[model samples]
Structures are given as structure tokens and as C-alpha cells.
Target: MKKILFTGGGSAGHVTVNIALIPRFAREGWTIDYIGSTNGIEKQLISSMPHVNYHSISTGKLRRYFDLQNVKDPFRVVRGVLQAYRIIKEQKPNIVFSKGGFVSVPVVMGAWLNKVPVIIHESDLTPGLANQIASRFSTRICTTFPETVNAFNNRKSRYVGPVVREAIFHGDAARGLAFTGFSKSAKPTILVMGGSLGAQKINRMVREALPELTKHFRIIHLCGKGQLDPTSTHPDYRQYEYVNEELPDLLALCDFVLSRAGSNAIFEFLALKKPMLLIPLTKQQSRGDQLLNAASFERSGYCKVLQEEKLTPQTLVSQLREVSWDKDEYIQNMSRFQQNDALALLHQLITETAK
Candidate 1:
């Protein structure tokens, strides 16, 4: 039986790609195993997959600071790498596919040491450091943005758009409100989300600006797990930590969207044909290249970039009140630009290289 190992998790951006790629791998008669950081969101997500054998290693983040915490992390990496090596040895998987969060480091490093083919897929216009560092040894690197090639030193990088779930490619805007519980009659159904943790700055602005926002459009505010204040109320506002059942349907109905510029969120919004306003986190190192992503999309006319520091209730209300999207151009650009075959390509590349 064919077996492949995959790594990367912590956020939905990492987990979602695994979700998107796994079904395709299964269909092609391959068994998938997952390696992730212990006690993280990845464990919760992958544990339920019947065909996936999940393993967790003690891992930590890669930081730019020269702190005592940084000094303490090498032992974690040593332990993680050793654990990953043992998992790989037991599974003897054909290949390892990575989506470059710090969790992926040991998995790919172990896979390389074990002579397993390693492939990395990056889902941003700017590649993450984990991916870039891993790419040095990756058999191949796949990227969503063609322009991102300059960000990598790997020559084997392929310009493949993000591998979104099959559900997203088939989203229907007409029935979106039914799924999100907003008004189908509402001309613009704005979906507002700020990554999994929710952007406090954006959420605060939206909360302050809600009265004005509701005047122009019904809103779906997917406040991250703990971000909502619980005091805000609106007849036209739907709020949640997450909505899994009908996300695609809700996305389809959205006429406008406000979200963080995380790689997955950007691709998902583009797939749904929703024009966007991106509020990238400007928090310290999290400034970790999101600004570049926001700038790129803003320049392309696909999204309006809003800085977290600069976003205010008045600014958001003023913009949302008058902003009009070029639906035709958006649809055309997104359809032509989207690489819907990302999962298939990953499956093919990993399977081929594994042999």
C-alpha cells in the first residue's frame, strides 16, 4: 500500500490544505499519516480522520529574538526531530508533504534524513520562513503566487495556486444567506473574519462601526475563538467562532468581505468571488511578511488593504459605505487566476517523487 506523511498545523491555514489534499490522496489509493506538534490545534483536526495515522512531536516556534526562550528551544527541536525520525521509520512512508509552519520543521528534516522524498507547498505571495528554510532540502516546492518565486532559492518551485477545499470551488452565492442566516434580499452580504484567533484591532473597529455597517449590508462576523465581547448585538449580524457546516455556501453569498491577509483566507475569498478588504496583523514579527501580501492584493485591485494600526471605526464606516467592487473583473481575475488543481498537483508530485 502507498503511504505518505504530511506535516504542518496550528492554524486553519495549515490544516485546511491537509483537509483539501487528503481526500485526493485517498482516492488515488494512498494512505496518509500526519506529523504535527503535540497539544496543538492540529491534533484536534487530524485525530478524527479514519485513514490518517497521526503523530505529534514536541515542537516550538522559530523566533527572530535571541532570548533565553530561544536558547531553550533547541532541545525541543532535538526531541521533535528524533520523534519524527522514529515515526517515519515505522511508517516508511513514500513521501512527506509540508505546509511550512514551525511544526513542519522536524518532520521534513527527519524525512530528509530518512531518505523519504520531501515536498513543500507554500500558499502565499510571500513564502513563510519555515517553508523557505525547509525548501533548501525539499525535493520540490510549490507556490500559489508566481511572483513568489523570487522569495525562494529553490529552482524546482512550481507556481500552483492554493489547494482549497472542493466545496469552495463549487460555492453558490444565491443560497449563501440561508447558510449564514442573513437576508438573501440584502444586496451585499459582507462576511467578516480575522483568522482563527481573530484580529482584535479589526474586530474592535467592526464592533464600533457595526451600526453603520448594518445600514449598507448584512454582516457575518466570524470573531475568532475568544475575540468577541459578548455585549454586541445586531439584528442583521451573525457572529461565531466558527461555522463549519455551510462556510462555502456563506462565502458564495458574500458581496463584500473583511478579513486578515493570511494565505488561506485570501485564496478562499478569491475562490468565492468576493471582493475583500484585508487587515493584516501588524503585531511585531507577525508583521512577518503579511504587509507584503496585503500590498500585493491591494495593488491587484482584488482587495483594499487596511493596516491594523490605522483602522478606525470612522475609517471603516466611511469605506464600507461607499466602496463598490468591480464584480466582472473580480470574477474574471479570480477564475483565471485560481489554481483549483492544487490538491491534485500535490498528490501527483508527492506520489511521483516517492517512487
Candidate 2:
């Protein structure tokens, strides 16, 4: 039987595309194995999946800032590389697929050292530090954004669009309504997501605007881990620390979205054609990739961008209203960009690269 190794972790975004591809690979009877940090969200996610062998390795965060940890991280990285090399040698997989994270660098390098072909997927317009380092070892680079292809400057790079999970397409709105106990007669429902880690600023502003927002819309907020406000008592509002199996139904019920501009999340929103108000992380919080992701969606008329500096309860309400007004336009723009075959294209690349 054919075998494939997938590696990526840190945030849920880094592993989402890999998660989307796993079922397809398994269905085709390929042996799937995942290498990720022991404590990262990836392990929590991938380890739960049946038929995929989960392997944990040492990993060091690749921070751009001058942290004291930087001094010790190189050693961790070296250890991770050695661990990954050992796993690759033992697995003898036909190919390694990377979804770009700090943990992925070692795996990519180990694959290179072991003479295993590697295919890496970058979801942002620009490559992250991990992907930049892993790029040299990869045989092919797949990108979600068209502009990202040029950023790699590699002959093997391809703009294959985003790998949206098939489960996303099968969301049951009625089931979602039942879960939320939201009535169809009430104001339109708005789903708020602050990414996997949640956004503090977005959470604060949304909470502040709840009095006004709940007047016009029932809110379903995925507030990230440990960010939930227990004091919230609005009958029209429901908050979840995080969601997995219920996310599809939640997306199905949402008439609009208030979210951070993570590429995977936004693309899922786009594929579902949900009108969105995107609040991307500022340069201080991120490397400004979210800003670029948000800007691209805004330019395409698929969503509205709200800068961090300009975020306020009043402004949040106004932007939400604006996006709701333009919902049809956004949906129309999204419809023009058909992504139904994106997952198939990526799977094909993996299979062909394996051969």
C-alpha cells in the first residue's frame, strides 16, 4: 500500500488543509501518518482521526523577535530534525506533504535528507518564516492565493486555491438552529470567530457591541479557548470556547460572519458565500499576513476589512451593517470564483508527486 506523511502545526490554520486532505488520502487506501508537536493543536486534532498514525516531535517556535528562547531554540530545532529523520527512515513513505508551520521545517528537511519528495502548501499571500525555510527542501509548493505563487519564485509553485473541507459544504442549517435554539423569526444570525486562538480585541469589541448587535442579530461567537465571558446573559447570544464537529452546522446557520482573516477560515467563509466583516490582526500581533489576507478579500468584494486601530463597538456595528447590506454582491463575487475542484487538484498533486 502507498504511504504518505503529513506535517504541520502550531495553530489550527496550519493543520486545517492537511485535515481536509486526510480523508481523501485514506479513502484512496494510502497509509497516512502525521508528525507534529506533542502539545500543539495539531496533535489534538490529528491524533483523534482514525487510520492516521500520529507522531510527536520536539519543536521550537520560529519567532522574529529577540526572545531569550531564541538562544535555546536552535538546539530544539536540531533535535526535531533528528527525530523527524528517524521517523521518515522508519516510515519510508512515498511522499511528505507539509502545511507550513514551525514543526514542519524539520520534517521537510528530514524528507529532503531521506530522498523523499515533499509538497508544501502555503495559505497566505506571502510565505511564513517556516515555509520560507522549508521551501528549499520541497519538490513542489502549492499556494492558495494567486499572488503567493510569485512569492515562492519556484518553478514548481502552483496556485491551486484553498483546500476547503468537504464537511463544510454539507452543513445543516436546521440542525445549527436547533443547537443554538435560535428562532428563524428573529433577526438574522451572525457568527463570530476569532480564529482558533481567538482575538482579544475582537472579543472585547463584540462584547461591548452586544447590546446593539443583539437588537439586530442573534450572535454565535466562537470565543477561542479560555476567552469565554461567563457574565454574558444575552438570550440572543451564545458563545463557544471553540468548536469542531458543530462548526459546519454553525457556518450553515450564519447569515453573516465577524471573523479574523486567517486564510483557511476566510476561504471557508467565501466558499460558503457568507458575507463577512474581517478584522485582521495588526503587525504587532502577527507578521501582518492577516492584514494582507483581509485586504485581498476586501479588494475582491468578498468581505469588508476593519483595521485594528479603527475597531470600536460603534464601528463594529456599522461595518457589520454595511457587509449585510452588500451580502448579495459579496456572494456574487464569491460565486464567480469556483473552488469546488481545489481539493481534487491538491490531491492529484500529492498523488503525482508521490509517484
Candidate 3:
């Protein structure tokens, strides 16, 4: 059987594309293996897949700011590379595919050391730090944004567009409404997403603006783990800690989205033609990738940008209302977007690159 090794982790954004592609490889009878950080979210996400063999490696968190862990993380990363090299030597995979996270750097390096072809996929407009390091060691780079292809400046780079999960396209609005106990009231439904871990600032602000927001729109909040408020309740509002199978239904029910500017989530919203009010993470909180992602979507007229630095309960309410008023225009711009069959293109590329 053809064999393949995959690696990515840290955040859900890093691992979601791999999750989308894994089942395809499995159905083709390929033996699959995954490498990830010992305690990262990827371990939890991939462990549920019975067909994929999971390997844990000692990976250091890649941070930009000064931290005591920074001094120790390099050694951990080196150890991870060694462990990954051994695993690759034993598995002897035909090709290695990485979705680009801190854990992926070691896996990509190990694959290069083994002379196995390595393909790295980047979802953002610009590459992340891990991907930037792995790019030098990679055989091919796959990008979601057309502009990202130029960012790489490599002949091996290919613009595959966004790889949206098939399940996302099959959501049922009826099922979603039933699941949430929400009626087809005159008010439109707004889905608030703060990513997998939840955004404390967003949760606080949204809750603070609930009295005003609920007057105009019904709310469905995916507040991440342990982010739910036990005392907060409203007839027009619903909250979920996090969702898996039920996510599609919820998406189908929502007419608008208020979310952090993660590339994967925003693109999924775009694909579904949902008007969005994006509040990207501030430069102080992140490397500013979210800001750039939000800016690009704003320029394309698919969403309205709200900088987190300026985020207040009042600002949040006003921006959401603005997005609602301009909803039709946003949908029209999104309708013009012709999505690529990225999963198929990526599958073909991985197959051809395999040894």
C-alpha cells in the first residue's frame, strides 16, 4: 500500500485541512500516519480517527515574544526533529504532507533528511513562522490565497485555493433551527465564533451587548471550551461550548457571522456566502496574520473589518448592524467567488510527489 505521513498542530486552523484530506487518503487504501505535539489540540482531533496511526513528538511552542520557555524550546525542537527522523526511517512513507504549525517544522525537516518529498500547505496570505522555516526544506508548497503563491516566490508553489470540508456545504437550516430551539422569527440569526479555544474579549463584549443585539438579531454563540456563562440567558440567544457534527447545521441556520479573523473559518464563511463582521486579533496579541486576512476579505467586499484594538460593546453592536445593513452587497461579492476543487488538486499533487 502507498504510505503517507502528515503533521501539523498548535491551533485548529493548522490541523483542519489535514483533517479534511485524511479521509480521502484512507479511502484510497493508503496507510496513514500523523505526527503532532504530545499535548496539542491536534492529538485530540486526530486520535479519534481509527485509520490514522498517531505519533507524539517533543515539540516546543513557537512564540515570537520573550518567554522563559524560549530558551528551552529550541532544545525540545531539536529533540523533536531527531524523534521525527527515526519515525520516518521506520515508517518509510512515500511522501510527507504538512499543514504548517510548530510541530510541522520538525516533521518537514525529518522528511527532507530522509530524501522523502515534502509538501507544505499555507492557509494565510503570508506564511507563518513554522512554514517559512519548512519552506526551505520542502519539495512543494501549496497555498490557499493566489497572492500567497507570489509570497513564496518558488516555482514549486501552487495556488490550490481553500480546501473547505465537504460536510460544511451540506448543512441543513431546518435541522439547525430545531437543534437550537430557535423559531423562524422576524429577526435574523447571527453566529459568533471565537475560534476553538474561544476569545475571552469577544465573549465578554458580545455578552455585554446582548440586550441591544438581541433586539435586532437572534444569537448563536460557540464560545469555546469553558467559556459559557451559566447565568447569561435570553429568549433569542443560544450558546455552545464547541461543536463538531452539529456545526454544519448551525452554519446553515446563521445568516451572518461575527468571528475572529482566522483564515480557515473566514474562508468557510465566504464559501457559504455568509456576511461577516471580522474582529481580527491585534498585532500585540499575534503576529498580525489575522489582521492581514481580515484586510484582504474587506478589500474583496466579502466582510467588514473590525480591529480588536478598537473593540468595545458599543463598537461591536454598531459594526454588526452595519454588516447586517450591507448583507446583500457582501453576498453579491461572495457569489462572484469561484471556488477551486482544492482537495482534489492537493490529492493529485501529493500522489505525484510521493516516492
The best candidate by TM-score is 2
Model 3: ten consecutive residues of lowest lDDT = 147-156
Tell me the tens digit of each residue's lDDT in model 3 across 1-355: 8999999999899998999999999999999999998888899889998799999999997888999999999999999999999999999999999998899999999988999999999999889999989999999999999989987856979999999988899999999999999988989999999988999999999999999999999999999989999887999999999888789999999999999998988999999999999999998988989999999999999999988878999999999999999989999999999999999999999998884
Best by lDDT: 3
* Model 1: per-residue Cα lDDT over 196-300, one tens digit each: 667777888888898888887788888887776778888788888776646777787777888888887787787666778777877574735678777877776
- How does candidate 2 score on lDDT? 0.92
TM-score of 2: 0.98
Off by over 4 Å in 1: 172-176, 283-287, 325-340
Decoy 1 TM-score against native: 0.92
lDDT of each: 0.79, 0.92, 0.93
Off by over 4 Å in 3: none
Ranked by lDDT, the better of candidates 2 and 3 is 3
Give lDDT for model 1: 0.79
Better of 1 and 2 by TM-score: 2
What is the Cα-based lDDT of residue 267 in candidate 2? 94
